[model samples]
Target: MTKILTTQNAQITTAAVEVKTLTISGKQVTLSVFRQLREEPLLTEDVTLNGVPWGYVNYHPDKCGNHRRHLHVVWQRGADLLRSTVYAPEVAKFQSVWAKLFIEAAIAEGLTKRSAESFGISKIQIWPHWATHPHLAEFSYGGVSFQAAIREDFADAYDNNYVSPYVKEKAVAITGPHGDAGSIAALKLPVAEYLAVWDALTALPHLFIAV
Candidate 1:
């Protein structure tokens, strides 16, 4: 099943200003916007298949052709890289040029069609497995509550006004409504391991039985 998920910064309420994300089962398509005071917000977009990188569109002022605005795409896994025509950084231009075409490209490239059953849901709602911290998402799965909190690796950078995308690492603990991490099995892993951990936790029902 295909699902579309979107999010915005905590202080922002308008949909026009929010980052848009689209997913088809475990596949992810991210459209990120950087707000600008004097022009259209710059955008970076990527499509990932089964948690692996696939295609992207971004602006690099130093690159040749169209002043560095173009789509960098991979047609299939283990396939050659393909570049599309240069595009404007505006959101509307991106939607017109890359959005539907990338979906077609992914289909032609043999992307998997995942079943809904392969995905799980938390008590609150269905959570996107690929989403990371700083998004303020909280959910429970396999009788364990999970919260996506900001990882500390980027703390100093954030304090100094520098930001890095490689900062998300999973830190998980099992607890009740008001329990702390002190009395639980707390551990940290990257996003891949975190998903595996939850799968294992949910599959092992015998371990959850009380003595």
Candidate 2:
């Protein structure tokens, strides 16, 4: 049997809610689904891992603040949380990405993969897992040095007061050999590729193991 819970929010109307229990890495977890109808219809899922509050999966119809209309998965890692946003056009892709992240996080946390597979969390490839790529350490192109010491700059604009819409408010500072620094938006990659590289480069060090 399926269980459903309903809640109300002042800004959005709750269309539906459903809760399900899932077993991951030998620990029981809860997955709560919320469908909201506002300016645009969106769905959110609150996840718990090993009885600890994990994170959330949110879907926005259009660009909302920093969140794109694409699927956004946010998960906890130690004291901080990491987010990965991907353009998933189909429901199957959404589910696959969600499950893939859950499994990866569980395994990174010293959990056994066999248990998760037994619980039906099969492996799926949605995006390039650059975290474990051997060439990642040597990757550089478009005059941007990714291997160099990367940092985040929260300033309003870069040199010459030039602000890029791609960088939004906060930007990742990548330095060049001539002591020049710029945001990842300077790479001039496509939106999807830019996000992929950004997520890979900014991911927490402990989340990935050497390949």
lDDT by residue (tens digit), candidate 2, 1-211: 7645556423565788444322345544322212221121122221112121223343333444754234443444455333444332221132222222232222222223234343233332222235653211111223212221111121222112344544432221222322212222232212234334334433423221111
Candidate 1: tens digits of C-alpha lDDT, residues 1-211: 7655555523555566433332334444322211110122122232122222333334322344634233332222333222233232221122211222222222222222342112221232222334553322233323333334322332333233333333211111222234322222222212233344334322322211011
Over 4 Å off in model 1, which ranges?
Answer: 1-156, 162-189, 207-211
Q: Residue 192's C-alpha lDDT in candidate 2?
A: 38
Quote model 2's TM-score: 0.18
User: Which pairs clash in model 1?
Assistant: none
How far residue 132's Cα lies from its native spot in candidate 1, in Å, is 25
Query: Which regions of candidate 2 fall more than 4 Å away from where they truly are?
Result: 1-25, 33-68, 79-193, 198-211
Clash number for model 1?
A: 0
What TM-score against the true fold does each predicted structure earn? 0.15, 0.18
- Which candidate gets the maximum lDDT versus the true structure? 2
Name every residue pair that clashes in candidate 2. none
When summed lDDT is taken over every stretch of 10 residues in candidate 2, the lowest stretch is 147-156
Task: Output the number of the TM-score-best candidate.
Answer: 2
